[model samples]
Target chain A: MVFTETGTEIALHAGTSCSSGTCGAGIAQNPVQSLTPEDQRMLAAFRPETVEAAVKKTIETYKLFSYTDKILVACSGGKDSTVILHMLKKFGYAIEAITVNAHIGCYTDENLRNLREMCAKIDVKLHEISFRKEFGKSLCYIQSILKAKGYDYKNCHTCGVLRRYLLNKYSKPLHPDVIVTGHNLDDEAQAVMMNLFRGNLQVCARIGPKTGMVHDSKTDHNSATKKKFVQRVKPLYFVRESDVVKYSKLHNFPVYYGECPCSSDTYRREMKDMFKSFGEQRDEVKEHIIKSFISISEPLKAHFMQAEGGAIQECLICGEPSSKDICNTCALLAKLRDNKIIKS
Target chain B: MVFTETGTEIALHAGTSCSSGTCGAGIAQNPVQSLTPEDQRMLAAFRPETVEAAVKKTIETYKLFSYTDKILVACSGGKDSTVILHMLKKFGYAIEAITVNAHIGCYTDENLRNLREMCAKIDVKLHEISFRKEFGKSLCYIQSILKAKGYDYKNCHTCGVLRRYLLNKYSKPLHPDVIVTGHNLDDEAQAVMMNLFRGNLQVCARIGPKTGMVHDSKTDHNSATKKKFVQRVKPLYFVRESDVVKYSKLHNFPVYYGECPCSSDTYRREMKDMFKSFGEQRDEVKEHIIKSFISISEPLKAHFMQAEGGAIQECLICGEPSSKDICNTCALLAKLRDNKIIKS
Candidate 1:
């Protein structure tokens, strides 16, 4: 299963049987093709010499590297991450899988079970992290506690922040240069929209293939510092959500076929609905938005980095690049602890 | 306990009291002195010669009246609504109170309980509804279900939307010429900031003292139009949140003193924090925002009335203005019912 930008179609070309070793028809190949106008545009816009060329380009841009840099794909075992992992492996990059089983009391264990099976098939090392083990808390318990405390954000926010925290802290010993995430085009576009909506140009600058404040030289401190914030990359930054879904389907990829358990009460859904109302105008308007963002973001990005006194302080609890005396992850854990939630 | 906008120093002199006297120092028998500097200025500016004069000079110019006919107050049995009601009553206008209790969730019960006690004290009549009574679901239940459905907005958004829906629909049968709400300067200004942050000019137009939407000749349907989105008025439009808080405390008025159960999420809270860091600059900024809003809104309000097709067909289930066959509220409730929600 493969995806391309500027086009809506996913080409699922099955590998020939090891014994046959030829690309002619009936060597046991199932070639599924999706050809749509959306696909056509995506392909043309994000054109590459080959899938390998695209892969190498993404790796260099996202810095998914290793001196033994050991790239850990923070896979939900979802289509985007799976595709990312598969491509990285194809390019012969050192890689492993990290799955955070943030349960919503539904489909989580099942997804993890499926992910384990996929790891076995791929013969790659897969690491699993569970909220239950770390906090002795299930999704329900944490949700109830947060609700009780009048914590503001929706459930998905909690799941996301906690997942990023756990993935980073747990993977620290391995010292991976990159944590390859599965953020796709729609996700990137939404962040940009959200940031703009709130007049948060800093957030717009802070998110992307090379996200975060690099206080070591990278900019703004009053706003979201890229250095303090983790740098994130989207290998599928140009891939549409639809293509990923289709590719996963056609390839029989063991992906988590569900929405993020906590995303139901957010404005992004509102934006999606508004975006959908545009019909054929949707992609064009969205692309227009993205292109506008590219230009709008550059000066601010450089401006933020050059601002003085912007430094990443070491976290007191954990030696991560932090803006405060302690990092957000450690602060959150401390909050959890203060609430007696460490063993919830 | 009283409030006068004359900018006097609230002299508690042992002098003659006016008609219907409730005096603190003494029932003053002497004639009152002439107006102070601020009072003279206001008298010169407002020139409240008659009801029409008052309406035209102060109210109309500032948009205090949406309709010259009926009065409908969104009451919480709090000082804000109570004061609006009291003033409307003094002005010899028809008026009533609409209160939608969000089932209190134990905490809110205390608020409503206090409100009811105060209403009893003031002899202010209240028409009461609750999330449980009307929708057969607690906010908690609705929230959990919506969360499950992959919806994600700030919790306040859901609460605000539901309250608006209920208030508007219930006000439909009363057939008031205008719906009067206790939205003071703070609420209006905060909302304006929120809209601008989100790049939503349309929604911002829907707020303020005399919500200019009713006069938009283009889509200006009558208050009794099937959509039931009547005009909203705020007598306390110029009152600051701090002033309101101070007035309520000074008068020993019955008021809900806590924050909304779900407001500390999203960009508004962030804005609030940003303003807090700026101290009184918030008030200056708010005044500036509201001034700008009025300038833009006056013409937009006229255009809004003239605009057509803003309200689509009424929801079949609820008979409310809806874009689809059903409204988002009714649709959400239906989902809840399908999930066996008790109230829905």
Candidate 2:
């Protein structure tokens, strides 16, 4: 267990005082006393101070948010996002949280409860959106119908694209400066590997600390035009997933621990497993991969971006920003509708 | 077992009447009748027809060697090089073989014996180089002394650099147009991964099918100079190591199957294992990685080569063309001599 100098000072300053557990800025309540030696070491390495330091570094490096900016954290009641939300609040940042409830039965209810509990504890506002309310069908039903039609789409893929579409669509009204995500180093590294494996070098432009451009067909494609993209930020972009898990456990947040029921064998999962196994041998492999990716991403973008000279266009069906006439989300929905699975 | 349309014709034309087992042109006797079904399948995929087609394609793509040029096969009595030597011979190309006897006890004897037998059968000239004759001590002696000095250099690393240095140095008198190596897809892909892990993008320029430009310090660094590098080529660049093994065994080549006595765990070996594991899930992963490597090699070369404008220098000690004043081999030898591990 290692602690930064500041972390050690905080631990020493708060020796068994402040029972509310909020006084020790980044020091936990010595939860190490109850854990096995191995787990204790793991938890100690993930001390709030270390994780917080990484988050702070990422935020500063990417210029994620300012105190005056409206920061909207896309909370899924998962350990990553929950930790991010808690850390931002601890840092005295003005932040709001939003959760898209796909209404996956009891799981959805539990996730909502977790979000509400954390929001109440931090005295922050929580916004809940439902798939049925926004799209008139549960995600489970949509996936099932698509599967029955032999569409053979992955549930996580469908869920992720639709969820991002909803988050972006709904956040426009909120007028937030940035949409913060809980993407950690493991997630980002896995995503980079996935893109490499799929030979999608152009997609690398959408990675990095602060990425995703607003390619609005409604406006001129000229650089002078002010882009309206609500830049997404990942404060936990440098922290490892294991560290986040340890931090979550140390804080004892009521975040949902269950995996999504629709999640199954996937390429992402395979890459994640490969990374974890490699991590066991070389601790900095994930960091190295991400570093290598960043070094080449710009050059790769320069080489590939020129090939993609076509300006963004509006999806004919949904009138959303897209490279093609139909947005990816609308295309999937169209497939579902063609099979009489859903109505507009 | 699968058979290429042309492969079956080649196999049938030879029949079982070739007493010396050398009459069949790139066709092996049906040893499949005695093997297990799985082994049969493996060997079927390594059919000489497929391997030959790959060789032909690589030669055409890289313009490796012409009919009039002399070719040197750097055969370490290994399966890859022996197979290459035989394949080129079967194709009616004028070829010579060279083996480096590093004097690692019985292993060296066996390697030399295998080379002699193959050379005798094919009636190709074989050149044997000895470490003790050239360097005044066996490789084992220098490595042991270096290990005592706490240098802790890997045996394979030392052997590889020294062998390449000797090959390039000795082949000058013969004036071979191209030095052919037995590197297959597996070796190339593993090398690419190793470079990525080390964050050595500059080293990537020395990769690909036909790589390594001779930059003479005495001449202009510009491209017009017709640099006097004996270009290296890998005819089996697209074949997998496993397929090479199968091909070697199917033809009953008396190649030494033993690994180098001092082989150590390395990043390359780890990558090879990773690739093999992935191969279990997707057989085309090795091919994909090689393709990915080739796609980026040019861009990587363009980005890095300009930064390396310094022309190759004559090694002050050995008078060989090198990137530095003193070549890598001379540097190692200097260290050995400094430690009294070698004598002038």
Regions of candidate 1 where Cα sits further than 4 Å from its true position: A1-55, A61-68, A212-215, A218-231, A305-332, B1-344
* Predicted structure 2: lDDT: 0.69
How many steric overlaps does candidate 1 have? 49
Candidate 2 lDDT tens digits, B123-229: 99998887867776666666665776788777777887678767877887988888899999888877766666565544554566775454435333444423444
**TM per candidate, chain B:** 0.67, 0.78
User: What TM-scores do the predictions have?
Assistant: 0.42, 0.78
For model 2, residues A1-344, the per-residue Cα lDDT tens digits are: 12243422121212233223322232233534445678667766566797788888888887777889999999998899999999999999889998898755555556677789889998989888877687666666566657666877887877876687678777878998888899998889788666655554446545678865544452334533224346788888888888888888788787655565556547787776666556464447777767766766555555554444643344565444445667677788678667754454
What docking grade does candidate 2 earn? Answer: acceptable
DockQ scores for all predicted structures:
0.02, 0.26
All candidates: TM-score of chain A = 0.72, 0.78
| Candidate 1 chain B weakest ten by summed lDDT | B22-31
lDDT of 2 at A67: 88
